[model samples]
Target: MADPRPATPTDLPLIIVAIATCLALVVFTAPLTTLDAMTDALGLSPGAQAWIMSGMPLGAACGLLTAGALGDTLGRRRTFVAGLWLTAASSVAAALSVNGLMLIVMRVVQGLGSAGIMACGLGLLGQVYDGQARRRAAAVWAAALGAGVAVGPLIASGLLAVSGWTATHWAVAAVSAALAVMAMSRLPESDRTGDRVDIGGSVLLIAGLACLMSALIEVRVGSTGLVTALLIGAVVLLGLFWRIERRTGNPILALELFRYPDFSGATLAAFASGAGVLALMSMVPTALVRGMGQSPMSAAVILLAWSGVTVVAALASGRLPERLTPRQRVIGAIAGCGVGQALMLAAGTGTSWAVVLPGLLIAGVSNGILNASLGHEAVQTVPPERAAMGSAANNTARYLGSALGIALISVLIAQKSGAGTDFFDAWHAAVIASTAFSVLGVLAMLVVSRPRGVVR
Candidate 1:
C-alpha cells in the first residue's frame, strides 16, 4: 500500500514504535521483581544473581554501540522485525533455562534484541515526524520510555504472583512475537544507507565492557587475582577502542560530540539517571522480599506509588517552556534526584513503605524530568548528521551506568553487611551509594565547559 497519510502523534506507525520501545525497555527490569523466586528456583548465589541482573544492560550497551550501523546497513523495518523475533526466541529460551548461567546468557541475548528495537524505534519516529509534530511525538515516546521503567516491576510481580517467575519471560516472548507480526503487517520500511560498518570498534567496546562488568561482579566473590586481571584487560581494551575511534574514518562512535559541553553534561546526567533510578528499581524488590519479608504482589502494590507518579511527571515535563535551556533543565532535574534519594536514605529499616513515599514521589518526578531534558539536550547539542550517534552515546552511557550501578550496589551491600551484619543496614548503605551517584552527576554537570556558540 502507498504509505499511509502523513504520520502524526496518533498514527499507527508511531503507536507501534511506542509499544515496541516500551516492551524492549521494560525487559531491562522486568526480571528484578521476580528475582527472589528466580534465584531460589535456579540455585543462584548472590554473585550469580548480580550477574543475571547486570547481564541484560551490559548486553544492551553493546547492542547500542552497533545497532545504528545495523539499521543503516539492513533496512530499518527489517532490523526491527528481526529484533522482535530475536527477543521472542531469547525470552522463550530464558524461560526454559535450567541453571543460573544459562538464564544469564539468555537474558544477555534478550537485551541485545531489546537494544536493536530501542535504537531503531526512535530512528523510525524521527523519520516519520518533523517540526512541532516531531516534538509532540518525541514527548510521547519519552513518556512511554519512563513508563516502562516505572511500571516494569509491577508487571513482573503480577506475572510472578499468578504463574511463577517463568511466567514473566513467557509473557515477554508472547508479546514480542505478536509485535513482530504487527511490524510485518503495518510498519513501513526506512531507506537503507549502507554506511561503512564499524566492526572493530564495536568488538573492542563490547569486550571491554564485558570484562569490566565481570570484574565488578567477581569482586564480590573475593576473587582478587581474577578481578585484577579482568579489570586491567578491560582498561587496556577500552583505551584501545578510544584510540581507534580517534583515528578511524567512519568510526562507530564519533569522539567529537564530547567537545560540546551540553552534550557532555546531558550524557553524564543520563548515565546517573539510569544508575540511580534503575538500581533503586532492581533493589527495592530485594529489600521488600529478602529484607522485610513481603510477598511479590504486596511489594508491587507498595511500589505502585513510585511508578504511578513517575508516569504522570514524565508526561508533565514535556509541557514545560521550550525556552528552558538544556543546561538549566538537566541541572535542576539531577539535583532534585539527589535530594529525593537523600530523603529515601532517611527511611531506615523499621519504617514502613509509607515513610519512604515522599522520597519515592520526589525521585519519580525528578526522574521523569531528567528523562525528558536529557533526551532533548542530547539532540539539540549534536549536529543533524550526528544525531543518531548522539542518541546511541546517550543510551550507551545510560545502560552502562545501569550495569555498573547494579554491580556496585551488590558489592557494596555485601561488603558492608558481612557475616553477622544486618541486611537492612547494608541495604541502607547501598541506597546511600546510589544517592552519591546522583550527587556525582550533579557535580559533573556543574563542571561541564560548554563550547563557544553553544546555548547554556
Candidate 2:
C-alpha cells in the first residue's frame, strides 16, 4: 500500500495536525480543573466524585466507537470537526453549570464531541499520511495526548491565578471554539473507499458501559440499595453486549480485531499501564487537597509537574521507535511506569512534598513514553480499512483503565484512612497498591514479548 491518497504539494496532514487533532487532547484534559471544585460545590462523597470524574471518559469511550462508525460512513474530516464543535459547545455550557449533576450532563455532551474528534482525527491522519510520515505522526499524536494532560493543569492554574476558576472554563471554551472553526475550514475529509459504518452494536455497547459507570459513580456517592441492583443489571447488560455484538453484522467493537497477539497484548498493556499511571493522577491531586493541605489551584500546580514532564516526553517520543526496537521500548516503558507507580505510592505516604516531586516527574515521563509506544504499535499492525476502529479501540482501552484506576486507587488510599485516620498511611497504602498493579502490568508485557525485542 504505497501512499494510496494523493501526494500533495505539502502534507494535508501537517495542516490538519496543526489545526484540530491537537486541540482535542488539550480539551480532554480540561475537566481536571473542575473535578475537585465540582465535588466540593455539589457536595459529592468520594465514590461519587470518582464517577463524576470518570463520566467524561465513559462517554468518551462510547463516543469513540460511535464516532468511528460515523467517520467511516460520513467522512473523517467532517465527523472529527463536528466533534470539535460539540466539545466546544459543551465546555461553555459546563462553565455555567450550577451543580455537579449539571456538570456531569455537560461532560456527557463534551465526551460525545471529544470522541468524535479523537476517533476521526487519527482516522483522517491515517488516510492522509503514509509510511514513515504516518509513523512519525502517530507517535507525535500519542505524545500530544500526554502533553495535553500535562499542560492542562498548568494552563488552568495560570488562568485561575489571574482571573479565577470560573474564568478558566471560559478560557478552555475559547480554545475549543478556535479549534472548531479552524477544523471546519482547513482539514480534508477521508476519501477512503470500502468503509462500512457499524451502528447496531454501537448503541448497545455505549448503553451498557454508560450504565456500568453510572452505577459505579452513584455507588461512590449516594449508595442506594437499588443502585446495587442496577449495577448487577448493568453487568448482565454487558454480557448481552458481547453476545449481541458477535451476532450483529456491524458491531461497534469488532471481536475479530482482538485476535492479533501484538495488538492484544499492547491494548491490555496500554490499559493496565494506564491504570497504574492514572493511579497517581487520581491520588496525587487528592493528596494535595486532602493530605498536604493545599488549595485547589495550588494543589493542581503540584500535580501539574507530573503533567509537565509528560509533555516533554510526548514531544520527544517521535524518535523513540526509530531509536530503539519497538518491543524493547514497550517493555522498558512498562517497567518504567511500574517504577513510577512504586514511587507514587511511596511519595504519597511521605511528609516531604519535595521527596514526592521526583516521583511525579518520573511518572509523567513514563506516561508519555508508554502512551506513544502502545499507540504506535496499535496503528502499525492494523490494515488501512481497520485503522479508525484501531484508534477507537486504543482510546477506549486507555480511558477505561483510567476510570477503573481512579476508583480502585481511591478505594485503596481511603481504605486505610477514616475521618480520624492518618493521611500519610492512606497515601502509602494507595501508592503501594498502585505500584503492585504496575509491576503486574510489566509481567503481563513480558508474556507477549519476543526475544529479539520486537512486539510481534
The 0-to-1 C-alpha lDDT of every candidate, in the order given, reads 0.75, 0.68
Per residue, candidate 1 scores C-alpha lDDT tens digits across 164-213 of 99998898899999989988878777776667777899899889988887
Candidate 2 colliding pairs: 47-220, 48-220, 48-221, 150-307, 345-431
Off by over 4 Å in 1: 1-10, 72-75, 184-188, 290-293, 416-425, 449-456
Error of 1 at 160 (Å): 2.9
For residues 1-456, what per-residue lDDT tens digits would candidate 2 score against the true structure? 123466574555555553455565555665567555566667866655655567677789767878876776677777887887787788888788777677777777877888887777777777767766766566667656765665666676666557655665676567777776766676776654444565556766787778766765565555578567767877877788789778766666778877776667777777777577775565677777677666766766777667767766765766554548665677787777777667754454336566667788788788777776776766765666667777777787777777667766666665655422467676776677667667777777678644344332
Deviation (Å) of 412 in candidate 1? 2.5
Q: Which candidate is the best by lDDT?
A: 1
Please identify model 2 stretches exceeding 4 Å from their true place: 1-22, 25-28, 34-52, 161-164, 192-196, 224-227, 321-323, 348-350, 416-421, 449-456
TM-score of each: 0.89, 0.87
